[model samples]
Target chain A: MQKSLLIDPGKCTGCLQCELACSYDNEGVFNPAKSRIKVFNFHDQGRFVPYTCTQCDEAWCLHACPVEAITVDRASGAKVVADDICVGCKVCTIACPFGTVNYNQSTGKVMKCDLCGGDPECAKACPTGAITYVDADWTGLERMRTWAAKTDAGQRATA
Target chain B: MKYVIAGAGPAGVIAAETLRKADPEGSVLMIGDEPEPPYARMAIPYLLAGDIGEKGTYLRKSKNHYKDLRIDYLQDRVKKVSAKQREIVLDGGGRRAFDALLIATGATPIKPRVPGLDLPGVHHCWTLADARAIAKRAKKGADVVLMGAGFIGCIILESLLSRGVTLTVVEMAERMVPRMMNDKAAAMLKRWCAAKGVAVKTGTKVTKIEKSGRGLTVHLDRGKPVAASLVVVAAGVKSNVGFLDGSGVKVKQGVVVDDRLQSSAPGIFAAGDVAEGPDFSGGWSVHAIQPTAADHGRIAALNMAGHPARYKGSLAMNVLDTAGLISASFGRWDGVKGGDFAEAADKAAYRYIRLAFDGDRLIGALALGLTDHVGVIRGLIQTGVALGDWKQKLMSDPHRVMDAYLARAYA
Candidate 1:
């Protein structure tokens, strides 16, 4: 079965380990600025939210790409930007509604989450279990279980 | 089924691929006049700017992409279409019969009515061949005079500047990108370009070009003639529907296609810049942008493959980065008839926002120096979600568009 990265922002510790791992694996660097995944610190909410490409079914970046450089990695179901094919026109950068695809000035090509070809580095490097590689079809299983436990009569009586 | 696609640009290429996926047994033929493989015209500026190589402009890197897919490729221009005959005549004096025909011929650069445009140093920077010619002459410190500062011209400004050329922009419009931006926003963009060391002359027209010493002199209607080693014309483009003159296809500013992208003639369809398809703001318009082209390709291809798909409409949006300043306009940015608009501008900070609303739905937006979370503006307009009370909140604080989008769109 295909796997996808499921992120739970509440468990994120703002450590940016996922960013470091992403950059190191994909970019061969430890710079968070070069990472595919980003940990946003909400100072007002005092929360850390790790975000990256959600790999939408009808990806705007994939369609907006005039050169067809962005393609789906069938193994991970992730839309990956082929560096060799990309021409760095920055069309996909604006096309992505989530603002995940970014232009790399140093390389003159666009970069986005590739899901590490299959084994995502961000999922493995998450210290707080905030990001996990789970079955794509059942991403909301945990959230449903949490709500289901709250609705359970026995649990309500014990509380 | 025999499928023939005119213009092997992005739209044609994607449509062909999508058709191949759905109809594996159908015969696909794509025709383009260019010598090279199908390439993105949008990437030509990057090639001119030295950001990417010539090979990088191709739509697909693999040389056998089309070949492997069994899609026949032809390097011949389409001369005319005989819709009644279900065939198209090629410039090479060849004719091909088609069960279905897609007119994705895109647009051609509009040549300004001026003399000496045929001179060696003068060119239209619209095609890859044009980029190559411009690159050779637009060397460091070369005196280059660019005519027009419209959307197409502005896109090439930074690329021209990146070559270290002494550039001067002459526009007939009142300001830069007049069609896409309001007077205030256009004025701000002009200032930003001027600060980037570009000589911008708005409300000016190039009257003539005369040969000079290893260069040329461009005569303007308002100012003194400027000396230039090269003259690059970015005036505008007209839809490439010349072949459709007697093909029974309805024509406006572009080929008039219906909600299904089919033309007046049966079995004939249009897409990309050539097709004046449905508009998001409630009409038909030719949104010549790349996103619209791609969208049209997929939707038209699905219909061609016997999958009925209704195109909602193409949104008219443009996000431009002039030098370093980012400016964007979406939908009816100038505000519709009897529509309400809220605006805020910090001229000193080079930041501006103008949100237009029709009733309770956000319809359009104009933004400058607000790149972060700008996509939300598109989301709000495209979704057409009723803002209700949040409309008032957005009017008071235009910067809270992201918050408004999340709340309203999800709610």
Candidate 2:
């Protein structure tokens, strides 16, 4: 079965370990600014939401790519940007509604989450288990289970 | 089904790919005048900046991507369209019949009628060859006079600046990016560029260009003639619809298309800068932006594949990074008649915002230096959400746009 990165923002601690690990794995640095996965800190809400490419089945970046630089990796089901082919027009960055894809000024190429070719570093480094690589089909499994357990409790209390 | 796609730009490339996927056995042919592989014209600026090589400008990375996909590519320009016969005559003296035709012929650069434009060192930065020629002469400390400060002109600003050339941007308009932004925002952009040491000559026009010793002299309407090693014309582009003459296709500023992206002539569709498709603001317009081109390609291809898709109309949007100052405009940014307009500007901080609204619905937006969640403005405009009381909050304090967006979009 294909796997996907499941993220539960409620469990996030805003520690940025995911960001650090991501940057290290992809860029060989610990710079959060350079990380593909960004932890957006909502200072007013006191919440941190780690966000990256969702690897959409019909990705806007893939469709918007003029040069056909963005392609779906068969093994990972991830939209991977071929750095050599990317002309750095930043069209993909604009095309992404989630704004996950970003332009790297130094390299003049757009960068996004590649899911680490299979094992995502962000999911691996999440201390709070906020991010996990799970079965793509079962992404909603835990949420359904939680709702089912609540319903079971309601039924038991009524009985 | 046989599909013929004219112009190998973004629109044509995407349509060809989409057609291939929809009909694996269908015959598809893409024709382009440029000798090189399908390349993004927008990336030519980056090419001038020395960021990417010529290969990087190509639309597809692999050399044999089209061949692998069985999509035939022809290196020839479309000279005439015989709509009745459903055939296009190429400039190289050949006619090809097609079941469906896509006029994605894009646009041609508008070079101002200035003498000595034919001289060496003078070029239009529209193609790869142009970029190479510009790069050769646009050396460090080289005097480069860029004629026009519109969207394309502003885009190429950083590239020329990065080349370490002494640049002078001449715009006939009163301010920079006149078409994209309002007066206030344009004035701010001019100031910002001036601070960056760019000689911005606004409200000026280039009258004549004369050959000088080892350089060229540009005569303007007002200021002293600027001596330059290179004169790069970024005067903007016109639709490449010259070949569509007597084609029976409805032609306005561009090929007029219906919601299905079908032209006046059935079995023929148009996309990209060459098509005067529907606009979000309830009119037909040529939105030459890249996103529109991509969207048009997909929708047009879907219809070509007999999927019967309807285009939701193209939104006029532009996000420009002038040197470092990021400015974005969306939809009908220059307010509508009987519309409520709100704006906030911080000249010192290099920040600005202008929101246009019709009743409670946000229609357009413009921002400079306020990069954080600027997409929210686009979202608000696109969704046409009822801002309600939050509209007043935005008018009072535009910085709360993110908060307003979340409150409205999520709520």
Winning candidate number (DockQ): 1
Worst 10 residues of 1 chain B by lDDT: B402-411
Which residue ranges in model 2 land beyond 4 Å of their true spot? A10-50, A104-108, A127-129, A140-159, B370-373, B387-393, B400-407
Residue pairs with clashing backbones, model 1:
none
Candidate 2 chain B lowest-lDDT run of ten? B370-379
**lDDT tens per residue, model 1, B1-411:** 999999898889988988898789999999999898899988888788887798888888788999999999999999999988999999999999998899999999999889999999999998899998999999999999999898888989989999999999999988889888998898888888888899999999999999988899999999799999999999999999888888888999998988778888878888899999989788889989998888787777777778777777877888776776778888888787898888999998899999999987888889888765565566667667689888998889887776675455431
TM-score of chain A of each: 0.86, 0.86
Error of 2 at B11 (Å): 0.9
DockQ for candidate 1, C-alpha atoms: 0.19
For model 1, how does the per-residue alpha-carbon lDDT over A79-134 read when each residue is reduced to its tens digit?
A: 99988778666677666655678766568677889999899999999989999999
Model 1 spans with C-alpha error above 4 angstroms: A9-50, A103-109, A121-130, A141-159
Cα error, residue B291 of model 1, in Å, equals: 1.4
